[model samples]
Target: DTAVSQTPKYLVTQMGNDKSIKCEQNLGHDTMYWYKQDSKKFLKIMFSYNNKELIINETVPNRFSPKSPDKAHLNLHINSLELGDSAVYFCASSRGQGNTGELFFGEGSRLTVL
Candidate 1:
């Protein structure tokens, strides 16, 4: 089984539409994060949850929100999606908090906003 998995590996939506990506990790990790990769392939962390608690939240637009029902699951919901939202969203998990642990990333959910 994949350590981390995300639903809808590929997503195509129109502008102003709302969408959500679901993620789950079976690695029993204590920390999880949502990262966005732009067209240029620059990766940036949007949010991080440790043990189901909000730990690191980057300065992303309010349209983007992350919810963690439990330690193993973290979901990203985007409202009023825009063209700038088109990119690859990755779900990753680590054994511990901070940058010391290795991150296991999902294949990535590619979002294309038209």
Candidate 2:
């Protein structure tokens, strides 16, 4: 079974549009996170949730929002997409104390802002 899964492996959209991505994990993890890998390969954490509670939210634009329905799922919503938003969005999960295990990553959802 896949440890983590995110929908729409690829996304193409024009700037100013709104879109969202979904994610789920089957590892029974207590924590889930959204990370964006820029074109330069810089990985940055956008948000993290544990047991349906918001835990970490980096200095991401307010246009980006993350929601966790349960410990096993987290979704990202972006308003007014921008060219700078084009990047690979990754869904990850780890057990409690995050550092306890390596972050299990989804293949990644590539968002292309045209």
Best by lDDT: 1
lDDT by residue (tens digit), candidate 1, 1-114 = 888999989999999999999999999999999999999999999999999999988999999999999999999999999999999999999998776499999999999999
Q: What is the lDDT of residue 10 in candidate 2?
A: 95
Clashing pairs in 2: none
Q: State the weakest 10-residue window (summed lDDT) of model 1.
A: 94-103
The top-ranked prediction according to TM-score is 1
Backbone N/Cα/C clashes per model: 0, 0
Instruction: For candidate 1, report its TM-score.
Output: 0.97
| TM-score, per-candidate, Cα-based | 0.97, 0.96
Q: Residue by residue across 4-109, what tens digits does model 2's lDDT show?
A: 9999899999999999999999999999999999999999999989899988889889999899988899999999999999999999999895563789999899
In model 2, which regions exceed 4 Å deviation? 98-100
Superposed Cα RMSD, model 1: 0.8
| lDDT at residue 53 of model 2 (Cα atoms) | 93
Candidate 2 CA-lDDT value? 0.93
